[model samples]
Target: MSLTLRIILLIGSLISFYLCVKKIKQAKLKVENSITWMMGSFVLILMSIFDQAVQWLANKLGFMASVNFVFFIIIVFLLIQVFIDNIRLSTLNEKIKNLNHYIALKENSDEREKNVKE
Candidate 1:
């Protein structure tokens, strides 16, 4: 690879690592999430280093190039993650709604009991 390309990849890898660390420190990302991000970034760095090897495999497999394959993989992973996140959020929302309903019912019952006592 060209010196420029190598330098750019190094910079990108460093930036990704730094961001992942910062997110973990700030509690913005859980440990598991940070680990996943770090692993993805590491894979990107490896792809950068072994680009030629990847290209050779791509060629053998009849794909266009390594870069294209990497992009496709990243897109698929992102879509799957988004789907999982949506499912988790929906479940959380349902739980919150159920809790709210339960609290309302309890309050109503308590009020009725107080009125009867008086």
Candidate 2:
């Protein structure tokens, strides 16, 4: 990795980490959701600090350049994050559907009892 790239990575990761913390402090972001951001920032920081290791790994992984490896890692991490979010959304949707069905049934049952009492 070039010195400039390493410096940029370091700065970017630091900024990302700072933003996550700021959002959490402002109650704009939940800690659970911020965990992935924090972890990703940490990984980038490590990569920036260990340029030699990044280069070696890139070579071993058959990437033409260490920068390409960094980008690949970032893309993969984002994909995983998106998958996790989708799973959470799916679960929430199922719960909402079940709750709506239960509510409809309760309303129907109540109406029948009211008619019987009348």
Candidate 3:
């Protein structure tokens, strides 16, 4: 990677890491969710610092350029993060559905009991 790209990545990663922490501290982001962002930022920092390793890996992987490999890594990481988030959303949706059903059943039962009493 070029020096300019390396510097940009390094600064960007640090800023990302800092923002993640700030959000967590401010209670705007959950710690569990921020873990992925923190990890991703750390990986980017490592990659920025170790350009030689990145270049060698890119060559071995048949990438046309080290920057392409970096972009590929970032894209893959984001995809995985999105997939995991979808799984969590699905689970939450199921729980909400179950709760709503339970609430409806309880309300119905209460209404029926009131009618019988009257």
- Model 3 C-alpha lDDT per residue in residues 1-118, reported as the tens digit of each score: 9999999999999999999999989999999999999999999999999999999999999999999999999999999999999999999999999999999999999999999999
lDDT of candidates 1 onward, in order: 0.78, 0.97, 0.98
> TM-score of the candidate numbered 2?
0.88
Better of 1 and 3 by lDDT: 3
lDDT of 1 by residue, 1-118 (tens): 4556656766787798899899889989888767766877787678778878767877788776565776776688678778978998999999999999999999999999999999
Relative to the unseen true structure, what is the Cα RMSD of model 3? 1.1
Whole-structure CA lDDT of model 3: 0.98
TM-score of 3: 0.93
